[model samples]
Target: MKNYQLKRLSDQPILQTSDVKPSIDGFDVLGAFNPGACIVNNEVILLLRVAEAPGARPGFVKVPLLEEQNGVPTLIIKEFPEPEEDFDPRVVTIEGKAYLTSLSHLRLARSKDGIHFTVDEKPFLFPARMDESYGIEDARITFLDGKYWITYTAVSEHGPGVGLAVTTDFLDVERIGMILPPPNKDVALFPEKINGKYVLFHRPMVSDIGRPSIWLAESIDGEHWGNNRYLFGGRGANNPRFAWEGGKIGGGPEPMLTDEGWLLCYHGADETHAYSLALALLDKTDPTSILDRSDLPLLSPELPWEREGFFPNVVFSNGWVRWPEGSDKAGQIWVYYGAADDGVGLAELVQS
Candidate 1:
């Protein structure tokens, strides 16, 4: 089998921390990455995951938390004693618990050429529900049933849950609440129904017995998900040859229907927590049947920007757009990835 490779589009990141402004006055933009890509009205739309944190005070370490007040989510700040040494900017570890240094929200950006984008000043989707007290992140959009359905990770003290939302014109959005609750994320809906049922791919993190891996589920109404089947697990440290995914693996963008099968681009991390992208092909009818998979990464952190940032050595994605016919790059895949959890980068998936 020929190896799949991704052609990195630009030398610099497409969207960076500095390019995005914070939602709150005192907060600073930490990262703007992991966008969900789709085409609407002949334009490429990106729902960007924007991570922001407040400015550090003299002696106290402040963290932003969203709390529901009278059924409405409100942003609040909590202070903790500053750590003397080994201060990590991404997270604050106190006692045995951990708190994220920044809160993430989804913002919208549009590009006519799929390269340069005009970002929105405000957030498209933020922490509103109680389950999203920590943040809403890593959205995957699927245009099914005449509406744009979005599945994102809603995080809180409860853990990461899958939340659903729907939009018609991207102007007004309606929340469908949490579907798959806690210890689960990286959910992406299939663009079309299979065998008269809606299908989706999700990742459920395991703590005690098993490792975090990909799973497949089906739904009748697209809201209540069931009939789950274990799809596959990451090739962790046990596999010396494919140790790039030694940590965990999760679903990425919506599956693309191909002549060969259902092509899925997913993310995996090594023992060192270095994330990379890989491809898998599942049976078109029965998605549970895996046809083939990449033994090596299609995209890895090789460049300086991808190797060094808020979280180093990561090239994770939840979104990609197939260049439409009649366009300059028809039938090709344009992947939008998060570079080291700090900035957004673009790549062309040159299938081999």
Candidate 2:
């Protein structure tokens, strides 16, 4: 078996310490940033997971906003009061109940270079309705048929599901509603339609029936998805310590098509929640057929920054850029991932 190793591309964090607020007034914390990557127009865009704490009151939760307070730049937090236990810290509760500890919203940032980024003043995406009252996280972008398709996680008291959104430009997005609901997420759309239908990679969590594993689905119109099947599951064989990736494996970035097969870069997490990057190959025509997979991780939590934070021992990627054909690094892949849930990290794949 050929050993696959992830070469660190950037030592410094790419997207770190976001300043976010809810509405015009709210208390803001250094929000967690992840799942950011390069897009069209040579602009590097980021989908930031903004976290805000409530106000100092019994039932009031604070939402943070960026503004000038008495002549200096300050974060303004808005307070909202609800019944006791309305905002649960552990799980999501809705309609006179508690919900996820922190409300997550998707904020945008743009950059000329993949490193330094400028956050947009407004949030690019939010939980407008009940199904997504819990918030959205982990956005994967794919440009297909002239439009960009974004697949993200929709959280609510019910459970975690997959949501879809489409946009030609980042300015405005069309919400396609929840495509895959309840107990599913980590969706990545194939670059192009297969056999006149769209193909997507997803992971469905089943604690009793099965473990959290990657799956595949097909759709005619990007909105409606069906025909689901399992792609892969937990690590085994001569693979790395099973405990390191025992919980689940998820699709990451867009799969790279090569003469060998579809090269998929994915992340696996263990019981401890430590994450590492691994690779797999799928049939070009039928992605469900596994051709080869790196038993061990291509990248893991080795860097100091990637080994500690909100969640320690994690390196998660959602986006990457592939060089055009004919170049020296034609098939080289650049991945942008989160480090220990604290900040962003970068890595590059040199195709052999």
Candidate 3:
């Protein structure tokens, strides 16, 4: 049965690489996608992952690096010999260390009707500290404790980890530092503490040894996390038997609280390596307990836009908003997701 109505589809990308200029430096914004969704002042707020790559040079491939010199913002251009290293447009691997083909920063975008978005021309956050030298990507926003909390993937030479930041107005951001260590991504927190403890979902990966699986954890004060429980992922050496999601899976946007249970929309890749959206129901009282899961994906790459660009056949979302009760569009969910890892798209799911 069809559940989602790609009803208000944006023919082109709502947010794309060409939408915004490069960060303070001369780096070009290669991709502006994977926005974490939230509603503030009756407007849709998206924390967008903005990836910037260096300008083209014939023999040298450049990677933008953010640094600080005497309290002044600086951009360090890291150049590599084009032929010596494996140079992909998205990744430059050198001496076994895989570095991003571009540096990423988070920018803000806003919308009133939840369809048309107005992205901020200027960058809101950039990589400067050593821990985030590689920059940040894929933020999951949660409103808790009187403020909006952001859990994003922090990349660096050390590895990819999860970091926390809080902002009440989306203007002044207070970073709480890394919450989950390296080899981890896809982190999101429930809006409220369950049974007096904060709950978080994360996908942790081990290099060449462990499988990438979603893990559930609890925190007392939202700072330190513990009591981890494996959630779900592909099994049996990359073929878990689940065809549409046999390759791998990761937690999507913040789970929505419903009368029936906690509704989770996650992304999974099958043997064909196509990324699609899957749904599941988790126990409200004990979120770790799975109640129901869809046998097949609810949304897959169907449109030409969804099947083309940075990562073809991919539809990934980190943000969403429930329609306001007073609005005419109540009882619906607006999912803002990245299409093919290059631009943003939206879909609305009517509640059952």
The candidate that achieves the highest lDDT relative to the unseen native structure: 1
Per-residue accuracy of model 3 over 1-352 as CA lDDT, tens digit each: 2443334356666777677777666667778889999999888899899887878889877777656678764768878777563456777776677777788889998888877778887777777566788888999999999999999998888888998999999999988999999989999999878999999999998667766788899999998999999987654354455677777789999989988788888888876779888777889999989888876777788888889888788888788889888887876788888988888888877643
lDDT per residue for candidate 2 within 20-63, as digits (tens), equals 44532544444555664546666667777665455457655544
Question: Which pairs clash in the backbone of model 3?
Answer: 37-319
Output the lDDT of residue 114, model 3.
79
Score residue 273 of candidate 2 by CA lDDT. Answer: 74
Give the per-residue lDDT of model 1 (tens digit) for 1-352. 1456788989889888888878889899888999998999779999999998889888778888886778777889988988887777767878777788789999999999998899998999989878998899999999999999999999998889999999999989999999999989999999999999999999998887998889999999999999999999987658788788878999999999988889999998989999999999999999999999988888899999999998999999999999889888788889999999889999998856
On a 0 to 1 TM-score scale, where does candidate 2 land against the true structure? Answer: 0.84
Ranking the candidates on lDDT from highest down gives: 1, 3, 2
- Candidate 1: stretches off by over 4 Å: 1-3, 84-87, 95-97
Question: Candidate 1's error at 202, in angstroms?
Answer: 0.5
TM per prediction = 0.96, 0.84, 0.93
